[model samples]
Target: MAKIIPFKAVRPTRDKVTLVASRSYQSYTQAELEARMDYNPFSFLHIVNPGYKYHKDIKGKDRYTLVKNRYLEFKEDGIFIQDEKPSYYIYKIVNRDGLTFSGIIAAAGTEDYQTDVIKKHEDTIEYRENIFKDYLKTVGFNAEPVLLTYPDNKIVANIISEIQKERSEYEFTTTYRDTHYLWKLDDKDSIRTISLEFEKMKTIYIADGHHRSASSVLLAEQLKSENKKHTGNEPYNYFMSFLIPESELKIHEFNRLVKDLNGLSKETFLIKLDAIFRIENRGNQLYEPSKKHHFSMYLDGDFYSLFLRKNNDAFKTALDALDTQILYKKVLEPILGISDLRNDTRIAYSHGKNDMATIKSKVDSGEFAVGFGLVAITVKELKAIADEGLTMPPKSTYIEPKLRSGVTIYEF
Candidate 1:
């Protein structure tokens, strides 16, 4: 069984939530980021980018101490205030695309993460875990929500619906054309009951934020080692997360752009792909892959689709069936000679928020030699991969609400 709990969250005063919240740091362009930090003195970005006031000599997360100090400053200024009591928050984000997602924000259990009860399909980088864990320890708070998923259960859905009628603590629509709503479930009996419902489940999968989850675990271990009286149920042992049902979750495409074709001409590459797949001539238009193991590629001023014919029927490997894997097995490895997507300088990824026109324009402007628009993986596939204890290629899925930070803080 999985155990999730409600806690007293430090949150921004309603008046400052708009200014305190922001998209993840990577989501902003250099110019856009500069403007945000410049214009909004209360922005949480200042904490994330504390180097601005510090020194050029100090870099990376070494400035975490400064960020923590700034957090204290916000509390002192009454910009952020801790809740009177423990509560569960209902968060709702409606994107410009007309998709609406709402879930409860609470502390998630990491006790059985290694046992695959709290499942994950992406491997964590040891270096990144150390970095974030150190930051969390210094700040003593969870500023971002770790995205997690659970299987479809009607009881869980009904519990959320029962809480839906209450007035939200924070409710507002943002400039990105997304409506965000948060309700404070302060009734102790209700929060306990909801937590009990979660414990009835056998598994909980992390849909995103492997690094943050790992950091929470590592930090919890340190606290336990330093203090013999430590309780396994402490707040530091868990992290803030928005637990959504797989049925409500949406995985958007993470598109790829290559700087060059590794000296292979377009015709030769097309011919090579034809040997194991069908080359679709969709012409110079947006041709999206419609199903699994299919890919849509825009190259050399034209668009075509590649259908991989290979399949392993005897062993139904979940990760193997991903379209991104099909690209790696067919195009990236044998054709392009780019083995590592992360370290390789040849490739880039665009989030689903970006349109296909950006891909076409980059190729047309001579910035990129080619672009590939991939079909998104299904939520069913994510669960299957996690169930099998398999990892996926980097940037395979882009899940969002791109949650606003500083609205709530789960503290030790």
Candidate 2:
């Protein structure tokens, strides 16, 4: 059986939650990063991206040491405190767009992950896995959670709803118009009950963070090798994870951008694509795919909807039926000659959260030649593929709520 546990997490104090919890460092641009460092003294970005603070001279140095030291400082400064007992945290976030989600933060076991009780759909890069493994080794703790989902479980739902009513330990709204609410499940009896409820669950899906979860498994293995008395029950055997119901999760598209037309003119490219697609020009307006076999294309400052009229037999496969899969098959492979999405130098992808205006702007400004906007893949597609023990096409899904760091820490 998959075993999940409640742990005494190191979390921000009530007053410092907003200040201490920040989005991932990569989310910020250089200018924005510098501005944050200058303005927000308590932002966790300083700990993760310390290079900006050391006059940018911290390059090639061990950043993990700085990260770990800063974490210790925060705890010593009373900015963060450990729970008195093992607890599950009720975390709720309402985005600026009014999309809301609430879930629990608990320790997810490596045994579960290895067993595919925690199913993964994305393929992790070996380089990224190692980089993150080293980062975890250096930082000595998990600051962000690997997002996971379970099929709707009534028992888990009842416990979360009942606990949320007892008043929250934290309730605050950010400047971005997103509200974050957290409740500490501090009682021993309650913790035991939550643990028991989750153990009954048959499977969990890795909704996001393949690299982080994979790295955690590797780190746990490394720790066991170095220590003689290592037990599976050690904190290292579990990683920080936020478990939400599958129904609560959202998936968005990862749009494609082509740097060049591969030496083909706009007219020539259209002629080539005409062999496979029935192209309808939407002109100067944003066009989204209305159905499965549809595509939204932006070329020379105009939008066009291309319909895949001829469905192939290969479309029945896990990777083939996908919109991104279709694009790879009929367009990227046959037309543009961009064979590999991961290693190819000709293409790039942007998340669905980036609006059509940005995609069009890049094409119109000569930064990119053309763009493709995709209708999002649903959680259904993800689960179906994972169930079949198959992986989705690269950059196929963009799952959000990317959780804030420094809010809750699970140390090994």
Task: Report lDDT (CA) for all predictions.
Answer: 0.82, 0.85
lDDT of 1 by residue, 1-412 (tens): 8888888999989878888888787778877877888899899888777776653434556687888888898899999999898888878787888887878899987676755679888888999899888888888999888988887777757767777787767777677878787888888787777788888889988988899899998998888899888878777778899888887788888999999888878888778878867787888778777777677788888888877765422236977777787777677878888899888988999876676778888889998998888888888888888888898888888986578877788887
Q: C-alpha displacement of 353 in model 2, angstroms?
A: 2.1
Off by over 4 Å in 2: 59-61
Who wins the TM-score comparison?
2
- Cα lDDT tens digits, model 2, 1-412, are 5577888999888988888888888878889888888998788988887766578646333777787887788888988899888888889888998887888998899888898889999899998898889889888899999999887878778878888787788887776778888988777776777677777878889999899999999999999999899878888899999989888898888899999988889999999878878898988877877677788899997899888767443466676787888888888888888998999988989888896777898888898999998889988889888888888879998896768888899998
Could you give me the TM-score of model 2 versus the true structure? 0.95
How high is each candidate's TM-score? Answer: 0.94, 0.95
- Model 2 clash pairs are none
- Candidate 1's TM-score: 0.94
